[model samples]
Target chain A: MRTSKTTRATKAFEKALATRPTGRCVLRLYVAGATDRSRQALLRVRKLCETELNGEYELEVIDVYQQPILARNGQIIATPTLVREYPRPMRRFIGNLSRTAGLIVGLDLETKGKGAV
Target chain B: MKNNGPQSATPTARLPKCPTGIRGLDEITSGGLPRGRPTLVCGGAGCGKTLFAVEFLVRGAVQFGEPGVFMSFEETDAELKSNVASLGFDLAGLVRRNKIVLDHVHIERSEIQETGEYDLEGLFVRLNHAIDSIGARRVVLDTLEALFAGLPNEAILRAELRRLFRWLKDKGVTAVITAERGREQLTRHGLEEYVSDCVIVLDHRVNDQIATRHLRVVKYRGALHGTNEFPFLIGEEGLSVLPITSLGLNHKVSNARISTGIPRLDAMLGGRGFFRGSSILLTGTPGTGKTSVAAYFAQAAARRGDRVLFFSFEESPNQIIRNMRSIGLRLEPLVQRGCLRFHAARPTLCGLEMHLATMFREIAAFQPAVVIVDPITSLLAAGADFETKGMVTRLIDFLKGGQVTSLFTSLTQSGHALQQSEIAMSSLMDSWLLLQDFDGNGERNRVLYVLKARGMAHSNQVREFLISNRGIDLVDAYIGPSGVLTGASRVAQAAREKAETLTSQQEAARRKRELERKRATLEQQIAGMRSEYKTEEAELRRTDEQVGTRTRVLTAERTELARLRQADAIRAASRTPGKPKPKSKR
Candidate 1:
């Protein structure tokens, strides 16, 4: 069932890439340092943007160790946090970006919500 | 409370402390929270946990010259600043001076979602940046437990917190982590498990409908701390932990003396008055002139140019002044001159601790040399017996510490137990004067006596306490066959003695007159006898001269008769008979 879901998601992702939504999704991922967890979160968030945001989203990664002032301005508490900046109501997803499905739902990128992908 | 073994056995093994610069708190923690280690301060809602944390940071920055970082998870920077501004902490000014850094960690439960695994590295980074930006040596995570509600996955949160405390310790910055109190643990999230260097608990308890805030040091590692709970107040200055037991008997004493306004009373008190800075307990029954006596002392102190602070529990200041006026004590002038101040309040207006805190504040502000609490027993209605006693102890200790003479007037029930109510507080007093109302002589009378004077020679005699228009007077109560006489009885006794003395004086005058008359009559009788003796002497002289003249005439007549007889021998014999007759006449 998981394999079938992934294939279907891939086809929709292609369609989204071709259509290229007008409102570019702005994303920022805040992490502590160049750790394994931060790397995994970075890779996962990038993949999510490419898949769900149709390669039209702007993604930026912030290492809190280097730019701590930015982290404080962003009110980041937990490391490996993904912030949806362009969204009207800014949302924050804490923890390493290992649960892609929840992140997709949380970021409101469920393919226009055909019953939550 | 836990004692962490032999770590505090030696001075070298003890943990270096960071002085909090909080009143009574440093004395409780011996110095302060352990240096370079996180101290967990947990308390229930509205127990002053956040205030305590903020004060710690502010004091560190302002007083200790060590900059601090305040990372509040509950209140924003503006909110926290405004909240502590009431306590006179200029947080904004401190922040502008780079002595403090405020980081309000906004955490909302609805805004944050946990996916899988995470750590609080962002928080750690922000804290580090804020600290390094200001060179902060102190850090505060005020109510950090808000993170638990804002984020999911408690397991990760716990592990991250443990790491965060370790990081803070390793950073060599003293940190205070405030948390919500738990039902079964020290904190709601058991944060005590992470920050174990020291744990302080703040409590807001309402006992007998009186709410009081208490602070306790539950555990201290490698340091000795006062383990008992202490009453603390979030006053205008800041959070002050009133460690009542922290006051020792080592306060310097003054050998100076002050009067009680009433000269006779002063004479009774070792012919001087109460010792300077001495705590005096003036206990009496209702209408026994306790307040009057206290007013006298206050007036005396004010007259001597010593500032007097009067605490009236049973009457208003104006009322006290007016009542004292009836006894010729004019407090208005002293008040106008700024030598006397009156703080009047109802005992039931607040809790005992609040009352104590207010008294302390007044004492500190006024800096009075003499303090008078009129009818202190009314405070018994505010708390339990032991609590009242403790409050009095703290008050007296605070006063004596400043070398301020204090007078406490207590009202007692009119019975044999009049001397028993204030026994608990009498031990803390340097002198105790007992005033009683005697019901005799068809009227009630006030009598005062010194019950105890620790280091002075005080009169043990009771005196009649008379409150005339001239003021309070301590006259010798007539102690005679009947009993201690006062009021009208004393007057009547005095009058009777005066009458007796008059009668004796009149009798002495009458005896002196009688003796003088008898002496005059005897002298007259002796003069009359002398006159009679003089008359008899004159008559004797006349008779003797007449007899001599008759003898001479008889001798001449005998010569004529001898010549006429012309007889020879017989005439000689007749002349011899006539000569014998003349001899007989001689």
Candidate 2:
């Protein structure tokens, strides 16, 4: 009922992969207000998730101002924190999500060579 | 941030302080933590750092009418509330009244990745939301270092921490950040580098198998604070800090006197008793009735309708009360009447400071005019001699400052050894009474001598201290060559001396009667000899007179015969005178 962070993340990823054979990638991006850095991080992360996963992913953008509880629960420290919640392992990129090449490898898209899309 | 709104009603100019409302802490902090500044509290595990930070927030809300927000990175809201529930701080009620906000941030380091340079905007947002929701004037980040432990990237954590302090100050909210102490530095993750306005260190350790909690204000930016390690206590009441150094020697001196319960003992102390509000020390070897004397003093105070707080370290209250009843000192009635309160505790249970804190609290709550500590020597087990001395010195100052007369009993190893500790505190006492056992003629007896009494001409004579059903009595000691005699031996010596006096007196009476009888006999003998001599003189006189009468008769006859003869012989003799030549022969 109250599992640790690693176990819960593993179980959630397994459930998602079993439900969708295409291997869904669930991403959540937490940011402060509509600042330049937050907007830039949101644009890059959404473009990468939507293009590589090709409708096999769910992207949720959260502004810490209107809903700070979720941001804190997600352990979002930086202004623009992008978290890949599914795909067997959760990875975080805290900058403006710049360097799409590294973001792609970090998201496991390189291992599949964008084949899941 | 400086706008004069309801949220920013904290005065800006009044020393820039936030009073924590903990006993003895505000006095040490020179008010409290730096206002609207991030103060760091760091300690080892279970050292009371979190509790200290929580008390800061709770007291701010409850006492100062300022709300608070507690953001926990280690424990959940339920855990924090349950932990503080024992102290009677109704955290749930406070939260319900919107005076406290608890936002427990669940941070798992492995699940989150640090991509690049980032700021803690989400934490800032949540904290801002909590503060604005309840108009919190105080904020606490309990074990913020736990986040660094969870998040591996120390560089980013360190950078954001530096800015977080400034942000809290800019928001005009006094913040307390709890952290774990590093092995070398003040904090494990060096959080002190960021929250540097004020630093408090809490420590818990066991020495001689006795646990003691200590608090030290490591640094206060602009205010002078107590630098010494103060002993603190955590109990159902709350954390109480006890400062070892007395504030100053500014206590008022009282010249009024009170009785010592024993009338003769009072007489020894210049016909009255100890000066009111003065410290009195009772030192003696074991079983010398030191506790008894202290109890009598307490009873005397109770008899005057004044309250007394009796702290017994070696015996339970009921045990002492029962023991006193044997000596005709009924303490239970005094307790029942609410004039006397007894607190019995083992000195080894905690460190000396905790004991001091508890006593300070109890004294304030009871507001006693008199206090008695029976066998203060037991406290030595909790600390070294110097530590115990420091504790007693502070106690003496605190009690004297409150105008409360305090009586203390100490067990010394020997009558004259005067345990250096005993002597150390005796120097500060206004009166010192020494009780000792006088072993003479094979039995031990209690003797009391006033070693010193300030400002009064006290009697220096040692008195035999007696305890019986009638009560305690101090009688002049029967001083002899062996020493001051006491107990059955003293009574036996008195009886022996009394019998010797009677025998000598009877011998003197017998000699006087014999001499009187001899003088009367000699007078009778003289009277008998005088009467015999007088009779002899009478006999001699009568014989001489008879002889004279006979001779006169015979001479007359001869003369008559001679005259007739001389008329015939004087005519015979006178005739013999004619025969005178022949009468010359006649």
Candidate 3:
């Protein structure tokens, strides 16, 4: 069942890549204090990137505790802040990664049913 | 709530004004009272009429180095000094230094007779002489009511009082004439209606058992003054009026965010912490660790190279720092580095508005990123509920607009669970941390719950916390069959469990005793039955032996008789008579 799904997903990915192959996006997540929510947000963001952007996107995870100055400079007030630094407009979304749809829209990603290519 | 006059530019001329030198009072009256103008201060008894007049003259002479004259109709200089000694004002020192001249004018009302119309020329000479002796610029008449009493008719006395005020005004000297307030008018004889350059009304009223001293500028000509009833506190430092309504709004603001100390707390407040210019209210009951939380936030901000100011109304600065140290918060280093400042003053030192003004002035000078007012409720004792609420609202607005992260602590009364004051201040705050004493499982536990934080995602669950030598630590909330335990109920539950265990032990002992008694009774009965059976057996054995012996002896005698004499007769009779007697009897 897993092999069948991968093959089917590869087919769809190839079809989409064939149409729009140059528009790649990079995402970075800023988190303060290693809490369960932070870990969940990280995992969710990674999983969503893998499923949606696949290998075309670059992701960087910044732990604010290890870099307090960066957190201050970025004006990050809460933990699990996801920032689309590489993308245009440089939008930032703060929350647990549970809200995948909201993050997708906030990061300016193409939705599954609308605005593809 | 009413504005007294049209907004007009104050004529900054030589209108004799005496500087009260009482912090906000001087600022509110536009450089004190018309320098040498005789201004009447009328109020009821114990309404700080005497203290207000005394502080005006004493502060002018002592603080401003202006010589003053104080003439009293009620108390002597010694009595006045003793009364104000607790407030740290040295009235006698000023008198000895030739800066103050005190005169007690003793007048008997019955001895005076108004034979002819006369002005207060003698009183004027005495005042002028006292002023000349010390080169005085300020004069305080403790009670003009005594002078009124000395005159026979009210009509003549009222005219003379007006002339006296005019005379002092012409002398180019600032005079404070105190008069007892009448039930209907501003003064006992309506003297304020006559001389109307400036009329200040002092009121002492008890609302819901709280005594508050308020001063209202009834009329101040050529000066823009606050027309509201300003709360004033009379202490060792004389009279300090709390001016809450007069502050400029054009202050500089910063857009930076500051840390709240606890990393998790900071995370909840949007990884960076609170907005640089925001007021946070940490409200809870006693022993809920509100002070500890505030100290943690201050220390955190100070560590990050940001200045922090802490104003405590309950504890002294030393006591607050010492208590924080015991709870693992070190503020001494921050103080040494000039990044942290701790100011502690009694809430009763001044009225609520004055306390707010003092804090505003201090914060303005220090320009701290974070400021903490631990327990703002204690300072509200000097004003009414409406005044306190207004002051807090204005303070929140001021702090927020200044871009300073302000934290306030409030003690919630038992029955008043709803956060009425905090609710009023909620919209002005960027973050709200609600600390509470949760009673659960018969134990009182201190729990902190974030009610709301604008522009940041925060934990909604209430977390149990402990304050120790290291600092504040967030512990997991107790989850059990019973809810959280707190206060006296927790102790009573433990005692009850202990009593139950003791009762169970006693019950077991009682059962063991009952069983032992039953066993002993059974043993005694068994022993008695064994002895009776043994006796019966012995008796039975003896009877059997006797029967056997009789049988043997009879058999032997029968044998002998049978052999000796016709033998057959005894033997046959012994043997056959048994069968024959049976047949014959039948």
Off by over 4 Å in 3: A1-117, B1-18, B113-117, B275-277, B283-292, B302-384, B393-405, B410-418, B434-586
Residue-by-residue lDDT tens digits, candidate 3, B1-586? 1342332323444344667887557767877887667788999888988888878877787778888999888897899988877777788998899999888775544323222223343455567677877899888888878866655557756676777777887887888889999989899877777657788998987765566678888988867777878777664356767653356556555657777787767766667777777778777877788888888988888998989999988888888788888987888888999999988898877656557767877887899878898888787666676888767766776676567778888788754644676576666566788888776555667777888877667777766676667677775564446765434454555667789989998999989888888888888888888888988898899899988899878876766556556565664564554644554466
| Candidate 2: regions farther than 4 A off | A1-26, A66-75, A84-92, A99-117, B1-14, B244-246, B480-483, B496-586
* Candidate 2 per-residue lDDT over residues B1-586, each given as its tens digit: 5565745544433458899887778889978888889899888998988788889888999999999999998889999899899888889889999999998877766665555556778788889888998999999999897777666667777778877888899999999999897899999878887877899999887877777788899998867789988878786677887763357788999889999998898899999999999999999888989989999999999999989999999999999999999999999999999999999999877778878877887998999999999878887667877778878888988999889999999888764647778778889898999988877567778889899999999998999998887788988778889776788877888899999999999999999999999999999999999999999999999999999999978875777576544465344334333444554566
lDDT of prediction 3: 0.73
Quote model 1's iRMS: 0.7
Best by DockQ: 1
- Candidate 2: share of reference interface contacts reproduced: 0.62
Residue A33, candidate 3: Cα error in Å is 91
Stretch of 10 with least lDDT, candidate 2 chain B: B569-578
Q: Is the docking of candidate 2 incorrect, acceptable, medium or high quality?
A: acceptable
Give per-residue CA lDDT, model 3, range A1-117, as digits (tens): 999999999999999766643656777777655767778778887887777776678888887656644554453433566667665656656566665665666554654514432
Ranking by TM-score: 1, 2, 3
Error of model 2, residue B365, in angstroms: 3.1
Which residue window of length 10 is worst by lDDT in model 3 chain A?
A108-117
Weakest 10 consecutive residues, lDDT, candidate 3 chain B?
B110-119
Sorted into a CAPRI-style docking class, model 1 comes out as medium
